[model samples]
Target: MSVQPQSFSSLEQNTESENHSSSSQSWTIEDSEQTYQIQGWGDPYFSINRAGHITVSPQGDRGTSLDLYELVTALRKRNIGLPILIRFPEILADRVERLYACFDRAISRYNYQGSYRGVFPIKCNQHRHLVESLVKCGTPHQLGLEVGSKPELMIALATLNPLQISEKEAQSSLLICNGYKDREYIETALLSRRLGYETILVVEQLEELELIQAISEELAIYPAIGIRAKLGTRGTGRWGSSTGDRAKFGLTIWQILQAVETLKSYNKLDCLQLLHFHIGSQVSSIRVIKEAIREAAQIYVELTNLGANLNYLDVGGGLAVDYDGSKTQKNNASKNYNMQNYANDIVAEVKEACDQAEIKVPTLISESGRAIASHQGVLIFDVLGSNEPPVTPPPVIEEEEHLIIRNLWETYALINEENYQEYYHDAIQFKQEAISLFNFSYLSLKERARAEQLYWACCAKVFEIIKHQETINEELQSIANILTSIYYINLSIFQSAPDHWAIDQLFPIMPIHRLNEPPSKRAILADLTCDSDGKISQFINPKGQKPKDFLELHPLDNNQPYYLGMFLVGAYQEIMGNLHNLFGDTNVVHIRTHGKGYKIEQLVRGDTITEVLAQTQYSSEELLENLRRHTEQALEKNLISLAESRRLLNNYQQGLANYTYLKANDQESCIP
Candidate 1:
C-alpha cells in the first residue's frame, strides 16, 4: 500500500455552522489490492483505510468494506457490554509483519550487512492474549522479547524459552533484560541462560557490571552483557531526555570506559556482545533517531577497535506511534516518521558511520513497545448524558439597556459584513463590560447571560466572515479561532487516557459514526469524572495554532447510545487505570478474522464486586455471614419480618455476584 498524506483542518472550522454548505468534505479509505489468509482463519484481513473513515477489508477481497457497526453488533450479540476493548488479532499480525518488512527494505536499500531483530517489550501491554498473538505472528522473524522487571523476566522466560519453540524452529529468539538490577534480577537472567535461552543482561550502570561479573564467577556460567550508553543526541519531545547526559538509564562516557576495563579484567570481555541506548519513548523525528544512531554507532566502532566483542546495536525503545494522525514535531505522540522511513534512516546512518570507521555493521535491534502494541487495542466508551448549555431568557432591550445591547448587536452586524478589525476590538470591549456588569451587580443575571452568549455568537460570526478574507489581521483571526464550539464527551480522562491528563499526550479521538457530514460544533471533550479538571481542552488545529477548546460534534439522541473511540490506548491503559470512583476495568474482547466474518474468540468481563473486594483483602464470605447474622437478629427482635429478613440476605448476597457498578434486575423471593 502506498502512503498518502493526511490533512488536518482547524478545529474551529469543524464546527456545525461552518459545515453548512453545498459541498461537504469527508474522509474515505480505499481497499487494499493484496491479501493473504491465516492458518485457521479462512479469509485474509487488512487495514484498507486509515483516514476519516478507518475501514478493514478481510482477505484483501474488496467485495464490501466491513462496517465497524457490524463488528460492534457481532460483539453485542456475543454479550460484550459497553466500555469494551476490541482486540483485532489481524491488526496485530499486520503491525509485526509491516515492521519487519520496513527494516528488511531498509537493509536491502542501504546494502547493510547487519541483521535486524525486533523485540516486543512486554511492559507495554503484558496481557497473555496480546503476548501470545505477538509470539505467534512474530515466529517467522524470530522476534525477541524485552523485560524491564523481574516478574516480566519470568514471563519472558516461561513464554520465550527454546523449549516452547516448535520442531521446525528449534532456535530461541533473543531475551533482553533492561531496567535497574539487583542480585535477584541478575540471578534470574543467569537462570534464563541456564534454561538454554540466550539472555543478555543490559548493564544500565557501571556497578551492575561488577554484580554481573560476581554472579558469573559464582555460577560458573558467562552470560551475554549489553551496556546502555548515554547518547549525547536527545529527542525534542516529552520523552526526549531518555538518552542524553541527563537520562535516567544507561552509562556515562567515563563509566563506559570503566565497564570495558572491568569486563577485560574479569576475562569476560567476550560476554560484552551488545551496546544499547534509548532516546525516549515515541521518538517523533527521523533526524533525531538518525543522529543518535550515528553517535552510538561511532561509540560501537570505538569499542570494537578496542578489542571488545560487540555484535548487537540495541537502539532502545523510541520508535513512536502517531496517535493524533497529525504528522508534526510538536505532537510527538503522533509521529513525523513512519516505520519505513525510521528503519531506512537507522540502517543508512549506522552503515555510513560503521563504514567510515572500517568496522563491520553490528546487528540492529529495537525495543519498540508502543508502535507494535498500541494499534492492536482500542478503548470503546459509551457517552452518557452531556452538560447541556444552561437555558436563559433572551435580552430584553429596555431603554436603559439600549446602549449595551446595541453595541453587542453592532459587533455581530459588522462581523457578518467582514469588517473584522473594528468588529474584533468592539467584541472584546463589549464582552469585558458585559462581565464587569455581572460582577458589579449592575446587570441582572439574565442580562449578563444574554450578553455572554451574544459575545461568543459575534466572535463566531467574525471568524466565518474573515475565513474567506485574506486581508484580515492574523492575530485577531487567531483569537476568534478559539472561541468556537466545545463538545463534551463522556468517559473519565484519568481512567481512559492518563498521559493526556498527566503529561498532555494527545490521542486520536473521533465519533464512531457520522463521518459523511461536516462537524457542526467547536468542542472540547468533557469526561464524566466529578473532578473539575476532567476535560480535554487541547485538540488538533489545521492552522498550526495552539489547540482550541471547542470542537464540532454530531447531534446526539437522548434515548440512543453514543460512543467515542479512544484509539492507540493498547499500550498502558489497562495496568495504569486507577479505581477512581471505584470504576473498575472495562470489558475486554479478543477479535479475530474468521471464515465468514470477524469472530469474538474470548470475552473477559470487567472486574466484578467480589473480585474488586478481593483486591482490598476483603473477605466476601465473612461479610456475607456478618450480614446474615445481622438480619437474623433483626428478625428475632421483630424489627423485620422473618420472610423480609431472608429476602434481604438473599438480595444482598446475589448483588455481590457481579461488579458493584452493574445494576441488579431480579429480586430475591422471601422465605414465605
Candidate 2:
C-alpha cells in the first residue's frame, strides 16, 4: 500500500478528435456550477459569467458585478502580487439589510409590539475596517456592538457614534460589554455611560457584579447592567458544549438569584435592563435555537417578576452561515436554516413565552457575528507548481531487463476489465519484492528505477480499466487518491486560513476562470510551508455527498496561470492567523462596485521580511550589523573580495525589505 500509483493521470493524452468535441460541448456554465457546488454554497454573491470567469455580485444578481479574473489582472497591472484578501463592503451591507428585513417581516407576521435590534460581536472579526463598515451600514437600524474584552470595547467606542446617550434616544447605539472585567475595564465602560453612550456592563460572574458596583460608585455613574444566564437547553454541533451547566462562562440559576438579591440590597435592581445568554456560535439546528430562546425568555419573565426591570433580550452570537451550501444539518460547516427562519423562530418563541406570563415583550437583540461577516471576504492565491507523475510512455522491455521489471511490464500489458484487479495485486507484490532485492544488494539502482516505472505503469493501466466501472471498491478509491496530484499553492494555511487547519473548517475553493473547460485532474492543495500539516485535503463535496479528500482541478497550462479563490473567509480568519514558518499576512484590498465597474478603495500591504523578524524580537539594525561584521571578517581573511562583500551585504539588505511571500514571475504579469 506504500507504493504510489502516480502515473494514473499521466498516461498518454486521449487523441480522439470526436471525444474532445463531445466533452467541450457537454461542459457548460451549469455543469461547472454543479461540479464546483458554487450555487449550493455561493448563492447571491458568486457565479460563473458568460466568459467562463467567476463574477461577484455583492448585493446579489441585480447589483453591480465584477469578474474576479479581471480584478486580479488589474491588481497585477498595479503591481500588486498574488495571495490577496479582497473585501466587498457591499456584501456586508447586504447581509445586514437581510438580517433586519427578516426580523421586520417576522414582527409584522406575529403582530408583535417589540422591535428588533442587531449587534455585531467584535470577537468574530476584530479588523477595524470591517467593524467600521458594519457599524456604518447598521446605524440606520439602531445596530449596536458587543465586546468581550477591554480592547474590543475600545474599538466599539471609537467606531460607534455617541450623538445622544439617553435611553429615550431610540436611535442611539448600545454597547454591551460581556467578559471578565477588571476595575479598569469597569471604570472605562461605566465612564462611557456619562459620555453619552448606552453602555451596559454585562456581569458574567457574581464577582464581576461587586466590581461593577464599586467602580460605578467610585466614578459616580450608575451603569445599565445585563446578566448572562447559563441556559439549561444546550446547543447542537461542535460549539454545543459552550452552553448548558458546565459552560466556560455564564451564571447558574443560584448565582442569578444571588445577583438579584445583591442588586436589590444596593437599591440598584432597576439598573438591570438586559438579560443575555448564548447557545454557541454556528448553531446548525433551528430547534436548539428556539429551545434556548424559550428557556431564556422564561428566565427574563421571572426576573421581571422579581423586580428587575429587564427590557432587552440579548441572544448572543449563534447565527450560522451556510458555508457548504448544504442547507441542512448534514455537517458542522452548514446550517439547516436561513435568516428568515431564524428570525421567525426567535420572535415566535420569545413572544409566546412572554405572552403566557402576561409580561411586556422586550426588544429582541441578536449578536450575530458569523452570518454578518463570513460572506464579505474572498482569499485569492495562485498555484505555484504541481507534483504529478510523468507522461512519457512506459520503459521499453529488453531481454536484459530485471525479472521484477519484466513481471511489472507483463502485469500492465495483460491487465483488462476481467483481470485488472488480479494484475494490480501482482504488481504490488512485484514492487515490494524489487525494493527488498535492492536493499539486499541483489538489484542495481537502474533496475530498481525501471521496476518502479513499470509498477506505476501497471497501476495506471489498472486505474483506467476500473475507473468507469459501476462499483469502485475501497482499494480502488484509495489507489485513485494516491495517484492524485499535489498542487503547491502560494499560500500559508496558518496565516490565511487557520480555522481550516486548526478545526477542519471547510471553505469553498475553486478556480476563478476557465470554467468552460472540464477539470481533468484530482488534487489536494499543499501550501508553501514545509510542515506536513499545512495541506488542505478535506474539500466540500458536490450537493448531497460527504466531504471528499481531493479537489477536482484543471490541468495547468504552461502558457497561462491558474488562480484559485477561497470563499467565506471573512469571519474569524483574519484575526486568528499565526506566523507559522514566518509566513505573514497576505496583501489586502477593499473593493466596492459602482454600476457595472468596481473600484479599489484601499490596499494594505503585507508584512515584509524585516517586519516579521522584528515581531519576534529580531532588530533589523542589529541583523544588518551582524551581516556587515561577517562580511568584514571575510574581507580581512581575503576569503572574498571587497566588491563581493559589498554585493552580499546589499543583497541581504534588499531581502529584508521584500515581501515574505514568493514574488510573482515577471512573465506571468501579462496573463490577461
Candidate topping lDDT: 2
Q: State each candidate's clash count.
A: 21, 0
Encode model 1's per-residue lDDT on 538-652: one tens digit a residue. 7544322345345455566765555566666778777777766555666788876666566667777877666767778888899999998898788879999988888888877
Candidate 2 residue-wise lDDT at 40? 84
lDDT (10s digit) by residue, model 2, range 172-239: 57898998989888998988887688898899999988888888888889879999999999888788
N/CA/C clash count, model 1: 21
Residue-level lDDT for 573 in candidate 1: 73
Displacement of the residue 179 alpha carbon in candidate 2, Å: 1.2
Instruction: Please report the candidate that would top TM-score against the real structure.
Output: 2
Worst 10 residues of 1 by lDDT: 31-40
